[model samples]
Target: MTAPASPGGGSVRPEVALAFAVVGYVALAIFGLGMTSLVTNQEVISVPGLGQLPGIVGMTLSTAAFAGGLWAAVRRPHPSFWGVPGAMLGAFLGYLVGIWGAAVIGGTDLAAATAAMGMLATSWFGLVVLAAALVCAWSGIALVRTRAGRPRWPWERDDE
Candidate 1:
């Protein structure tokens, strides 16, 4: 929504544009996966062991959805390759806290909730989160690109 090329914003910040774009991509990805699951009548996504905990799966999935976008918003603005990952990690910790609070409020057992966090951190789900973060981080970087240097269609390449 904030891309400089996006209309009506008057040169909006690159980071903000990246954030918006990343979020849009993430949403589309999830929607597509959901649709695919519906069409096939099968589970295309799973959380490994977290699914057994009461509300943990939902909370984790909900937080996992946007945490990377938060990281990407700050990341591609400038490639602070070092600092950005740390910030991304902080955002992840915050997500865990949010999950904890929400789960407890929702009356999920404290031990179960705690265990769920442990399982998530140690499981392949952690890699999934990291992969998601990387995807979100790189995607917005492309939006700021002014030109595509690769092969173009006939009309585009044969400009008058």
Candidate 2:
């Protein structure tokens, strides 16, 4: 059986959408981590042996990821674009560099490192992913509904 066609007569593949969603969420998390690194003084003491938050690298990577994702969605309007994946990859790397590296370079020990990892993996990542997924799903559904006469735009009344 054939799938339904998009408003543009192209089939909107679920896999593609899922990919975008995942990438977008990861990018969001990276962006968040970058913000923390840039604004907060998470790095108290930096030693030669420790790895500090490379602010420039974190900001650049995070921004690139978000911009790339948006660009992909804008340029291709299709699910299979490299920009989306690039955005995800870049942001994920940035998050690792920002949060994980910061905690490590701040003279953290084995238990602290483990705890930080756990917090980021469970609380931070989980919250960001859940939020992104909800937003994406809602927006996608709204788009589909709008095409199906759901009137997504602002309300307009008839002139008297």
Candidate 3:
């Protein structure tokens, strides 16, 4: 069957939404990694007094990346459910890239790199992905419901 037209009178295919979401997520992930590195390595890079809270900085960056990705996925006039999976997949890939690149840049050997990844596996990475997926899924559903003239929030009254 043919795809439905968007609210703007243009057709928005699922693939388009997924592609945009993936690109956005990947870019955000890179940005997050850069920010985290800058913050965590302030001493090495001579950015005086900036590496005070690496954990907080990393968490903030991750949250922003997830939110930005979800927003991009849902911003289309007509978004598809595929956007949810797209966001998750993009985030996972981005995390892999960011972590692997960081380890390599830090002069970590293969064993060290494997250890670092293992540490992340038992730490925040999985939690971040799960949270982002849930949020993205909810956001996508809300976008679709809103487009269908339904209220997304509990406080939104259906006057019709």
Candidate 4:
């Protein structure tokens, strides 16, 4: 994979590290679950509606993974390094888990379920996340521009 850009290269490495960590975790979970299913000689771990549970942990890891990326991105002079892509991925994972859980609980057809998954995986969530990030970035730029280079602290910033 192409190495992602970074503020100082070190910061970017953390996101890569986090991605590797998540992959390791996913491997462990799959291995453990496979072993469990083997020992039980049943479909214990591969229950039809339970796939999303693993995804919850996956999304949690992804959120942390991309959050680190976001931090690194924000530290850059551009401040948009990997933020949009990272946040978009994080949001997509979150959406995946949410929609999967809903589908499982709602007993939706596989087509519908797959469609929902496709919506997130095919960059719908990314678009939404990009829009949100742009809004925040613009607001931040405006604030820094108008506030004499001093960031307005949340506690001190007015609600208007």
The clash numbers for all candidates, in the given order, read: 0, 0, 0, 0
Per-residue CA lDDT of model 1 for 60-90, tens digit only, reads 5444545454444434434333433543464
- The local lDDT score (0 to 100) that residue 35 gets in candidate 2 is 60
Q: What is the lDDT of residue 38 in candidate 1?
A: 76
The TM-scores, one per candidate, come to 0.51, 0.36, 0.45, 0.34
RMSD of 3: 9.6
Ranking by TM-score: 1, 3, 2, 4
Q: In candidate 1, which residue pairs get closer than 3 Å at backbone N, Cα or C atoms, i.e. clash?
A: none
lDDT of 2 by residue, 8-122 (tens): 3345443444456455555665565456546654432222333544333434554455445544443344433333445445454554455455655666665565555455445
* lDDT per residue as tens, model 3, 9-54: 3444434433443444444444544564565553221222223233
Model 1 ranges with Cα > 4 A deviation: 1-16, 19-21, 24-87, 145-153, 156-159
User: Which prediction has more favorable TM-score, 1 or 3?
Assistant: 1
What's the alpha carbon RMSD for model 4? Answer: 14.3
Better of 3 and 4 by lDDT: 3
The deviation in Å at residue 3 for candidate 2 is 9.6
Question: Cα RMSDs of all predictions?
Answer: 7.1, 9.6, 9.6, 14.3
